[model samples]
Target: MAMDADLVTAGVLVIGDEILSGRTKDKNVGFIADYLTQLGIDLKEVRIVADDTDAIVEAVNAMRACWTYLFTTGGIGPTHDDITADSVATAFGVRIDHDPRAVDILTRHYQAGELNEARMRMARVPFGADLIENKVSSAPGFRLENVHVMAGVPSVMQAMMDAIAPTLRTNSALLSETIDTGVGEGLVAEPLRIAQERHPEVVMGSYPYLRDGLFATKLVLRSREQDKLKAACEDIETMLADLKGQRQAQI
Candidate 1:
């Protein structure tokens, strides 16, 4: 599908058997989402897959083609299960080998005896990929075209994101406003619907919560345009005030 030219979009792929098995709880997805949102890149989708090669390859190919950037976390470590580098190389039909730059980084970080074969696995990068510096650990992540492969460790992944953020393309930040309607969603559904119809440019959602043992709704409106969001918010407030007045008269 053709993406909107005005918006920068992204997809996240979380790869690891441990995450799927619930052994490791995910912390990177939320962090990445908030990070992208702040940079005006809409995170359109997120998928979690195991260490399996086919699944990784498929997800990498699909997400990279559809979004402006695809960020994958996990499976880049120095173990048998760390197959992300190979899978991504296969997906892009590129050769995989130990990158001299990555090897040098790992070499400098580790002592002479510590840079074993297993540790060297971290240096295997897809051809023509630029290394993403990991400030926490020297085992660098890589950027191949639009795909960014980073370590699953939260701190390292966050550091990698910081390293890449400055190089990314961004759009206008998404703006949002919320209103506490002080009534149940059922009571204000029609008015909210009318408001949405009147302002088709704004996206609206109703979140119902319990307040003082009674149901109350929080209506959220989001838009890229500031003026449109403000206008829609004002309209909703006016409509809600009229509804409140009618309810008071009935009581």
Candidate 2:
């Protein structure tokens, strides 16, 4: 398969009480999805679990085993509910210890006042885990086996994603283009399917958006190769143009 044709998959484990209780909307999924999609990594599944050790461990193990890479967000901070590091260690049967590198990263940039025992808890990592660099904040995330543990905050999560994304294998990004058609999806379904068959590698879809009183449709064509995507888009545009002409003639 072409580098662009292969699929690289990942899974996300979101651990928190706020998310499960509906207090937090869990913004990490869309952020990570967009980021990884840009890098050609597909996010296959996402699991949200409360702050429970067994649940965290099971989810960590399961996702790591299933996906090419696994990521966990939340429950790694300084607070009492933070137990991700310990749970991850338990899942991998490793010991969790305070990593000097993490402590050093925190020590250099963060206020010494904030480096108290509670905050120092952030330095802990599973034995043999590799630290993931964080540019936005000094405190680093870490990786054990295929699982990459990251912070929950959107800003910090993005930083960690930037740090780790380059290290993973990625297929070529699926190039996509959209065209606005002031027509309903129902009218274009058959032609769209024909276009899809013409370019078997490209995935095409129509989205209907109701704005004000006008119902408009957007035809989206996506493929890993730029040429294929462009060709598919051109074909879709032509079909839509034909449909418009037919409608005008009918009136």
Q: Pick the candidate with the highest TM-score.
A: 1
Candidate 1 structure quality by residue, lDDT tens digits, 1-251: 23577678999999999999999999999999999999999999999999999999999999999899999999999999999999999999999999999999999999879999999999999999999999999899999999999999999999999999999999887899999999999998999999989998888999999998999999999898999999999999999999999999999
Task: Kindly state the number of residue pairs that clash in model 2.
Answer: 0
| C-alpha lDDT values of all predictions | 0.95, 0.87
Which candidate number maximizes lDDT? 1
True-vs-predicted CA distance for residue 106, candidate 2, Å = 4.0
What TM-score does candidate 1 reach? 0.96
Q: Which ranges in model 2 have alpha carbons more than 4 Å from their true place?
A: 1-5, 107-114
Taking all chains together, each candidate's TM-score versus the true structure is 0.96, 0.85
Cand. 2 TM to true fold: 0.85
- Give the range of the ten consecutive residues with the poorest summed lDDT in model 1: 1-10
State the weakest 10-residue window (summed lDDT) of model 2.
Answer: 1-10
